[model samples]
Target: MQGLDEQPVQAHNIDGFVFLYSEAQQKRYLSSRKNLLGHERVLEQAMESGYRTLLPLQFGLVIHDWESVREQLTVPKENDLKQLFAKLEGYREVSVKVLWDQSSELEQLMQENAALQAERDRLEGKNLSMDQIVKIGQAIERAIAARKQAIIGAIQETLNPLAIEVIENDPLGEDMIYNTAYLIPWDTEPHFSEQVEALDRQFDSRLRIRYNHLTAPFNFAQLS
Candidate 1:
């Protein structure tokens, strides 16, 4: 493990637990995006160090010394931390993102809905006013949202039984149909992945499904 300036990360044993840390001036690592990469690197290394369970600190924590580390972070929160660790044992976090071809979906919607087909027909080969175009666009947006929600619900239902917990995040763009995180027992990860693969094959033409192979349970951490 290495620090922001490439200094080796060292471990300090305090009150029966080991804290992995590196020597650095507190101000140097605060509020700087570049330094955040270094902070994440140290955490990533620690998380991959074969520990069965961990409680990760939020980024930008600026404990000045080992004494401060113990008194401020570990000592007071020891019991709660232990509980969190126990609860998180044997589980891991993974995320799935689903993207659809918007044009293809919209075309299907238009084909299925007579009202939408009529609206499109009304605009065909016409010098339509901006208001008319805007109204039609809004109607299409509503239809897309409704269809997207239904698909998300269906997918979640298919995957929920395999997970210990499910978290839904807002979709980022028009192409994104669903964004979600799942917490599952470590042993079930392979099976969870197989289900995701089946979903990919199920939506082979219209959607793309992706899942993270390694993650730190950031979503579950908040709950714990």
Candidate 2:
């Protein structure tokens, strides 16, 4: 709880976990909080309080009045909310974003893919037909897809032992392949994060791995 107040975090104890909100003086502070930093701190506080499960709210969740809070926490949604809390009791969300280093990946592909090399050689000759060019382009694309798939598969395999569920997010860019999240137990987080470090090394400077353990379980807890 050290420095808990120093940061722009002001919260309230709700039904199952602490809920963070912006106070009158904290309005500007909350507005400026970017990248969900304060929101993440709320999740950390929940975890510290022995509430392994959490119903993570987005940042900038401001409670305008106490009545709304009471109504939301009471009878109507109470039972269902408790069920969610129960389900998430032992789980914590962890995120992993695997970014492809295009230059490095392309270099590796060009070096190891004999077919692409052959295609390059064929394309080097003068008077190549349009169909030949298309075929060579298709071959290069397929080779890149195959290699990317293998990398993702290896990452999933590395994380399978530690995660309860895997959730894939939309890729960030042409060079970025996977933006995934996992629902792992509170106890296994250390091991899972360590595995990510191993993956970063195994990719050998070709893939950049970023992980956020304090992320909300939104990826896993999305409602139907």
- Best model per TM-score: 1
RMSD of each: 3.1, 3.3
Give the clash total for candidate 1.
Answer: 0
Q: What TM-score against the true fold does each predicted structure earn?
A: 0.81, 0.81
- Model 1, stretches more than 4 Å misplaced? 30-48, 125-135
Q: In terms of TM-score, how similar is model 2 to the real structure?
A: 0.81
lDDT of 1 by residue, 185-221 (tens): 9878888888888887876777887788567767877
Task: Name the lDDT of candidate 1.
Answer: 0.80
| Clash totals, every prediction | 0, 0
Worst lDDT window (10 residues) for model 2?
1-10
Colliding pairs, model 1? none
User: Top lDDT: which candidate number?
Assistant: 1
